[model samples]
Target: PAPTAAPPEFLLNAPGTWNLPMRTALASLPRSVWLLGLVSFFNDTAGELIYPILPLYLASVLMAGPRVLGLIEGIAEATGSLLKLASGIGADRMRRSKPWIVAGYAVAGLSRPLLALAASWPVVLVLRFADRIGKGLRSAPRDALLGASVPAHQRGLAYGLHRACDNAGSVVGPLLAAALLARQTPLDQIFWWASVGSVLAVLLTLLIKEEPAPPRPSAPRPDWRPGALPPAFRRYLVVLGVFTLGNASNMFLLLKAKDAGMADYQIPLLWAVVSLVAAVFAAPLSALSDRVGRRRLISLGWAVYALFYLLLGLAGEGWMMWALFGFYGLFMAATEGAEKALVADLLPREQLGTGFGWFHLVSGLSLLPASLLFGSLWEAWSPLAAFGSSAALALLALVLLRRWVGLPAQDGR
Candidate 1:
């Protein structure tokens, strides 16, 4: 008997089935989504080219230690987070997201070339701050735009695809750096070459057209305080704050890799492996959230984080470290997109920018204390204490999330 073909309508409408065909999933998105994804890809490429090397550079070249690394990342992210809150408000008032997006990318792009000239830790800190300032200005508005471009149902897939592109660039950037380093290229020269990707990313942003915001009656200005947001949204932010406290900068992980006997040139290769896994899995996992529910996927990702952090504390050999790093990418791929999509689900259309702003602010503000605490633990006790403590905190946060946060009304699951 010949098998009957399923109806096209069935494939298109079925829950959890949209992401099964990668090409079909992509074809369903708008042009703006693709453009924004490409923009992120190039932007991340430029950033990651320097990122994986930065800890090593500071440690070896400038003789900075782990605590200094924590301080720099904490300050940079905190500054960017503050600006993100401000920019989200500004984007809402101006009702023109593209300008903010362009300016932010341009600022960060312009700052990349200056790194080649950085001779001191303070100089690097200043440059890093400037780069984050650009990120702060653009992130919320850009996410708001992406959320607007896709339909309510497709938000997860859109964000997931965007993250996938970003991670893909992360993979490429390190591979490029590794190739150059293998040929004995100077770090400064690599930094100079990175500027090309930044330039290209900025140029691509010029072509992205914003979706026209729906018309609305003029009304009283809304409150900016976190208390004014819906109860569900506010509670979600609280859970995120809890989770982020356990989430220190990945630089610490790289530092751990080095301490575990991974060589300097091999560092970028290891970084690439993590990014490749993220790039491959990010979209599919995020798409699954669109069907299963964001909370479930996010919770699962945190569970994975807790598990790995515990194992990482026990890992000693180079192969064990590499395996841990590779699987750790799963945590990133699962959470990043689903988290944003959940934000979109929680907020009204007009408030998306501000909502995302507050979201980033909460995450960013907690990061300083998180990194400092992690670094302090490492310095005071041992790597085991640092990683183990993070794992415990992650589990606590997971419990809070499950008990306090209810599923959003729109989440069919």
Candidate 2:
């Protein structure tokens, strides 16, 4: 027998809900949404434990410089971006996602231990590559799983909750790192603890159950035909790619804080502040997108990001750094989940993994050039010049997108 109609509670419409359309949308969210959120919470907490402090560790502990930082980040991100496409294809071909998901997480988890053993900058590079390879393999499949699990109406909320939990981990991980640093814990020890956290994330993945893959069409579809994507999706991707080109790695931001004369101990606190703010706003802004439409929120996010980069470049003091970082967190809250939700809206159910893979590939690939350009500009001119160039690019992208693509309709499915 067909599954029974969802209970009234699950029907999305309920009395006194503030936004009836959004409420109806929320009602359709799947249990997998929250479960995946938990998985991200743990995984990102582990990832964040090392992420915020990585550049600092390279410079202070390993005695590397900006050029090396650029190379390492550029290579890692570029590799991961290519892998996103490969993994997506693999998932589609295998007709299985969970196994790849599990393998990816396991590889990432294992890579953390190697970080604990790194003896030189080159060793750190290898470990970072390994970790990112795991990220590259898993991100598309995991996102596809989330997209598959949720109803069309609630994609934003589902993606938002996932970002919230991921950002919440960002909050906790930095705090934990700060505490560990304060205790004079060795950097290797911190990596070891992060490895343990990754293990927990892998364990949680066991609990997640994906929906069966959709059956393929019997007739062969034409390859690369015109109107391949719904007009809305293609427009959205173009806009998103433009926005990402200017959104370089957070390492630059951290390095900026350090350049402002903030002590080593203070860096993690600043990151914690950013992550905390992101955690608070991610869900609400995502929920808001369910009402106001994701395009508007995304445009707003790009505008905010542009402003923050400009401020970071100009700000000369610690307090200004703190303020900018907080606002930066808000920018992340506005964009990350909304971006994922937009991708879900654009693609068909059967092609979710491929769509997400392509999405990750586009965004992730940009990081290489973004990071290299930022670093080279810093080395050649000044940090201000580097940041100013990125901000200008972002503004231009935002303008072009607004003029050309415009916003998608928000009918809540």
Candidate 3:
């Protein structure tokens, strides 16, 4: 049976019932969505705890440089991106998403603890690679499960809530890292502590509910090739790819702050501020996209991204970097969920795993070039040159999106 598409009670006009209706609207979502949100929250908490300090650890402890960091992040994401396609196809074939989701989380969860023992950049690279393989394995099917668990009308809100939980963990993780650092915990200790959240995340996965996928032999096989997807999805991917090419790994942003004289302990706090703003705004902005339109919100988000990049290129002061990071968070809140919701809108349910696989694959594959190019440009010319080029690309993508993609007809839930 299809998930309920009944208009949410929040849309009702009854006076005095507003608060109750809002709660009811959220309560109506399938239990799986809520559990998955918690799962993402814990998983991201573990990941983000390790992420903010990674650049510092690599630079100060492991004696690696910026270019090496770029390679590691780029290769890690690309590795995961490649696996997303295979995992998505496998999910459809096995007629189950839970096993993939559990396996992916477990793999990633297991990999983080090993980072504590990493003594060289190459070792870190290999561990990060393994971690991302787990990410790639789960991402598409996880997204497809979220989409399948909701009705058409609620997709945006569902994804928005999920991102909010994910971002909230981002906020908590960094603050926790900062607190731990203040207490004089060694970086390795922090990495070891991160495994706690990873374990909880994997455990939470055991309770999630998934509707059975179509039987393997009877499942509709959408061609995995990009050319075979709906034309609108292809065009959407084109614009997305263009925008993504400019979006380098965020480690560069923390590096920017570090270069501007921020303390090592302060980097996590700065990262937390960014995630705090993103967590606060993600749901409202995404729900707004549901009412207004995904394209309009996405266009505006890209525009904000361009401006943030442009200013970030010029920021020379720590205060300026702090302010600009908050702006960057706003950019994330606007697009992260809306982008996925748009994908769900453009493709049929049967093909969702493949569609999302393509989505991650494009973004992931692009990160290699994007990060490498940005790092190269920063080293060869100046940070201004690299960031300015990214801004220009974002603006160009925004224009193409507005001109080429129109409102897509909504497919049924």
TM-score of each: 0.94, 0.90, 0.94
Model 1 C-alpha lDDT per residue in residues 1-413, reported as the tens digit of each score: 11224312213233223444656767888898898899999998988888888988899889999899999999999999999988887887777789989999999998887988999999999999999999999999999888888776778889989998999999999988888888988888888878888998889999998867766678756456787777889988999999889888889999998898988888888988888888888877887787778988888999999999989888887778778888898888888999999998888777888899999999899989999999999999999999998898888888877788766765744
Predicted candidate 3 versus true structure: per-residue lDDT over 201-253, tens digit per residue: 88999998788764455545656877778998998888899998999999999
Off by over 4 Å in 2: 1-28, 221-232, 406-413
CA lDDT of every candidate: 0.86, 0.77, 0.86
Which residue pairs come into collision in candidate 1?
none
lDDT of 2: 0.77
Instruction: Pick the winner on TM-score between candidates 1 and 2.
Output: 1
